[model samples]
Each structure stands twice: as C-alpha cells, then as structure tokens.
Target: DQQVKQNSPSLSVQEGRISILNCDYTNSMFDYFLWYKKYPAEGPTFLISISSIKDKNEDGRFTVFLNKSAKHLSLHIVPSQPGDSAVYFCAASDLSTSGTYKYIFGTGTRLKVLA
Candidate 1:
C-alpha cells in the first residue's frame, strides 16, 4: 500500500504557544516528504520538506523531523498565531518517478489557534 498517515483530526493551541503534529507511514519506498498548510477553501501551500537522505528540515517558525527507521514524522510550529489556524497535510512522494511528482496526502489535521 502507498504510505503516509496523520492520525489526529484536529489540534487546538493558544496563541504564542507551540504546536506539534504527528504522522506515520508504512511504505519504505517513499523517499521525499512535504508538509502543507491551508486556509479555509484555499489550496495548500508548501511549508517544508525533507529528503529521505536527511533527518530534519526547518523553515522560519516551522520545523519537520523524520525518523526513517521508525516510519514516523512530525511538524512543529512555535509561537502559534490565530492566523496559523488552518488545515495541515502531510504528503510523501517516490523520488524514482519521472516528469511528475505525485503526492499522497493524509486525512488532514485542523489546527485552531485560539486567541
């Protein structure tokens, strides 16, 4: 089966606090991973990505870490703001594919940043 899983349906965090999201996968063949953040009704925007060759990636206030051996990954956001409230999706792709990169997304985690 294709891999990648985000178990939580939603997360609530107070503004200025840290938010953590979790994900898991079953397919070992996946070598590239990405995280996307989406506002209501809008398409997801790329947040950060990490290659299988690396264990971690960070961008501004967002960070992602991957543990290949355990098939797990996580997203971390610091100083969460109300504007940060949105749906987050975890996606993975196979690097061997050519031309196009197809992404398999998780069900989605809705993060509500409380003011």
Candidate 2:
C-alpha cells in the first residue's frame, strides 16, 4: 500500500496562472506534512509544511491545505511562472515515531510552466 501518493505525475500551466497539486495518504498515523520542490538534478527544497494540528500553512506564492479527517492535502501556487517548472514531492512523517522524524515521500509531480 502506498502511504503517500501523488496521482498526477505531471501538470502544465501557462505563466501567470494558478497551479494546484494534490496528494493523498493512506496511513492515519501520519501527523506532519511537507512539500518539497526540486529542479532537474538537484535535491528537493522545502516549500511549506503543516502539522496535523493545523489545517493550513502558507508561504509567499505557495499555500498548503490539509484535511486531517480525509487524509488529503494540496499545494497551490498562484501566478505560476516559468521558474516554477519543477518536480514537487509531498512528504509526511510520524513525529512521534521513536522521537525522530522520518519522511515518506510521494513519487512526485512534475509541473511545467508555459512561457
């Protein structure tokens, strides 16, 4: 069973439009969530995160919303630009796990911004 899943492998949007990415989890124990963005050949960089205790978190052009009851989450980026083209990964962790945080990542969604 996939604990974390990004059903859409890719998304394309024109510049200045809005882009939305979705993610789902099967494990109820996951309590912390994160979104990471990566460019080609580089490691993923943290974008935003939300704790199970909260429902939403935002940073600059990115926003993440979590529905704990539904075990679902999403990332939204407005005014998508060419520089936003990259692979986005959704990750989750059980912070209570042995008092350590280990990340479980989705396969990743590639976003392309059309200039």
Candidate 3:
C-alpha cells in the first residue's frame, strides 16, 4: 500500500504564472523520488525528482523539492503555459526496507493553465 497522497486535486494558473503542486507521505523511509506528468490518452511521463539526501532538484521549467522532516514534497513549474497543463504524480522508493527498492505512488494533481 502506498502512503503517498497528493494534497490538491487540481490547480489553475494563468499563462506565464508559476504553478506549484504538493504531495505528502506518511512513511519517512523513502529515499528515491520520481515525478511523472500525464496528458490525455497517454501514459505518465517522467518529470523531475530529488533523492532523500538532496533537498531540491531542478530541470528546465520543472523543479522538485523534498522536505524529509515534514515528509512532504512539491513540484514547481515556472512560466506555466497551456502546454504545461497535465496531471502530475509523485512516486517514491524505499530501499531501506528490503535492500531492494519498492515504489509507492501518490494520486495526481491536475494543473490547468489558463490563457
């Protein structure tokens, strides 16, 4: 069972505005992270992520920040555009449990970029 959950079901932002998506987890053992974005009629695509050792990771217009103490994480999209509208999901891996990684996925947050 996954202890991860998306804090918001949806978000609306004006074009060129910043969009932030949030997620929370009950387990503190998660070490690896993965962020995925999904569009209509397609599988989720990898976005960005940050490991437990790191507080933040960024790539292009995407950035992920992890707060281990609060067991929370967030994704930031800069200059949000119409093309950036999609469902974003967060997944985490816990390797300390069995030496192998087990992935836990959270619900998705739909982001709508309004023109």
Candidate 4:
C-alpha cells in the first residue's frame, strides 16, 4: 500500500529564516512528488514538485527534494515569512494500469513563521 506521512504536525520559524518540512512514503511504484500550501477555508496551491528521476527541484523561494532509496522527500522554504504560515502537504502520484494516476497525500504540517 502507498502511504504518505508527515512526521511533524507543525513547525515554527523566525522571519527571514529557513523552514524545512519532511515527508516519507512506502511505495516504490510512486514516481512523482509534490508540495502544496493551503490557507484557511481555501484550496491548496501548488508549491513545488520533484520527479523520481530528479534529486532536487527549486522554484524561487521553494525547493523540493526527493530520495528514492529511502522513500522520502522534503520541502524547503528560504527566508520564511509571516505570509508563509500555512498548512503544507506532501503528495505522491503513481501511474496505474488504467494509464491514469492516483495521488496520495500526507497529513499536512502547519508552519507558523513568526515575525
């Protein structure tokens, strides 16, 4: 079974610092990983993603890293700000026999970036 897990329920970081969020999975069949941020009563917004073939991917202030051997991944935010405070979710997708894909998401980790 594919299971995505976020070990930390929350994290606090000072403004202008860095925030690191971790995630782990149990399925080798999974090939893609993504991170999302959500605000209260709103839909999640895509933050970043890394494919199984890539070890790391970066986009502006966000970075996503994947460790296929350990079935683990992480998201990093530099210069964390108060506006970055939100729920972060790690998600993995796998291609099925039907030629479609299924996504499994981890329990979100709430980040509070203090000023």
Candidate 5:
C-alpha cells in the first residue's frame, strides 16, 4: 500500500561523525513532517520532526529542518554511534487533505555507523 516499495540507498558513517539524511517531497501541501528510526524487528522510534511553518527543530543529537519553498527536509545526526544504525524514515501529512492526520512515508534510507 505504500508508494515507496524499493529498498532505499544506504549511507555509511564512522562513529562519532555526523550523519545527514535527506528527504524531498513532491507535494507543496505537506504541512507536518516527522523523522523515524527503525531497527530490525522493531517499530520506528521518533527522532525529530518539524512543521511547515517552522524552518528548524532540534532535539539532542538530532535536528530536522524544513524548506517549504523547496519541498525538502533533512535530518542531521551528530556524533553518530554504532547503535545509531537503523533505517530512517521521513513522513509528511497535509491538513488540507483531511482533518485527521494521514502520513505519507518515504522509502527508508539505511544508515550504518562503523566503529
């Protein structure tokens, strides 16, 4: 049912380095955004997120920024660790589409942190 069915590209980073994940959406209507990290056999855990009205949001080692004019958003993970390895997902929803929240997810990108 998901639009993104292919295995996403992988990124490798050295431990203690910065890992940057990028997401670009086609729809300009997308208003809310979220970033999630999923480990094998486990549900995704929320990392960070931002709204269309806000340009940036940060939480601890994670930061997410939205560019409404460009229809793009990115996540930055600083001081990456081996335990940070996971599949990262970008999700977005538009309030105009429905009063309730219905998220459209991007094909996950796999991140591997090497020690």
Candidate 6:
C-alpha cells in the first residue's frame, strides 16, 4: 500500500503565478512531512517541511501545510517561475521511539511553469 500519494500526476502554471500541489498519507506514525524538488538528471532536493506538531511551514516562495486529522498535506508555490519546473515529491518520515524511522515518498507531481 502506498503510504503517501500525490493524486495529480502533473500540474501546469504560468510564470509568476501560484501553483498548488496536493498530497495525502495514511500513516499516522508520520511525524515529519517534507517536500522535495527534483530536476532531470539530478537528485531530489529538500524544499520545505512541516512537523505534525505544527500545521504549516513556509520558506520564501514555498509553503507547506499539514492537516493531521485529514491525513493530508499540500505545497504552495507563490509566483512560480520557469526554473521551478520540475517534479515535486511529498515525503514523510516516521519517527518511532524504537528507532524504526522510515521515509516514505509519494510518486511525484511534475510541475511545468510556462513563460
């Protein structure tokens, strides 16, 4: 079973506009949720993260929101740019007291920013 899922396979937006990507998870053990941006031929890089203790986290043009009760999370990018065109992935880490931490990732959502 997929613990994390990105319902949309892809998203397109005009440059300088807002882009929103949604994700959902089924694991309640997930305490840390993260977003990653990956370009072709490159590894995914960390974007932003939100802890289950917090509802939201923002950095510059990127923001992440987590709804624990709904088991959902979303990433918002303001003023999207062409450079932002890439695959976005939602990841969650389960921090267990027994040291059974594991990271689960969504399939990924390809975002294309048109000029």
lDDT of 4 by residue, 1-115 (tens): 4399999999999999999999999988889888999999999998898888899999999988899999999999998999999999999988543266767899999999999
**CA lDDT, every prediction?**
0.90, 0.95, 0.89, 0.91, 0.85, 0.94
Residue 42, candidate 1: C-alpha displacement in angstroms: 0.8
Pairs in steric clash, model 4: none
Winner by lDDT? 2
Off by over 4 Å in 5: 1-8
| lDDT (10s digit) by residue, model 3, range 10-70 | 9999999999999999887788888999999999998987889999999998989999999
RMSD of each: 1.4, 0.9, 1.4, 1.5, 2.5, 1.1
Off by over 4 Å in 4: 96-98
Kindly report which residue stretches of model 6 are placed more than 4 angstroms away from their true locations once superposed. 98-100
Give the per-residue lDDT of model 5 (tens digit) for 10-106.
8999999999888888777788899989999999988887988899999999999888887778889998999999999999889767688888888
lDDT of 4 at 7: 93
- Count of backbone clashes, every candidate in sequence: 0, 0, 0, 0, 0, 0
Query: 1-115 in candidate 2: lDDT tens per residue?
Result: 7899999999999999999999999988999999999999899999999999999898889999999888999999998999999999999998876377789999999999999
Off by over 4 Å in 2: none
- Higher-scoring candidate on TM-score, 4 or 6: 6
Model 3, runs deviating above 4 Å: 96-100
- The total number of steric clashes, by the backbone 3 Å criterion, in model 3 comes to 0
- Candidate 4 TM-score, true structure as reference: 0.94
Residue 105, candidate 1: Cα error in Å is: 0.6
Q: Estimate each model's TM-score.
A: 0.93, 0.96, 0.93, 0.94, 0.90, 0.95
lDDT score for residue 5 of model 5: 27
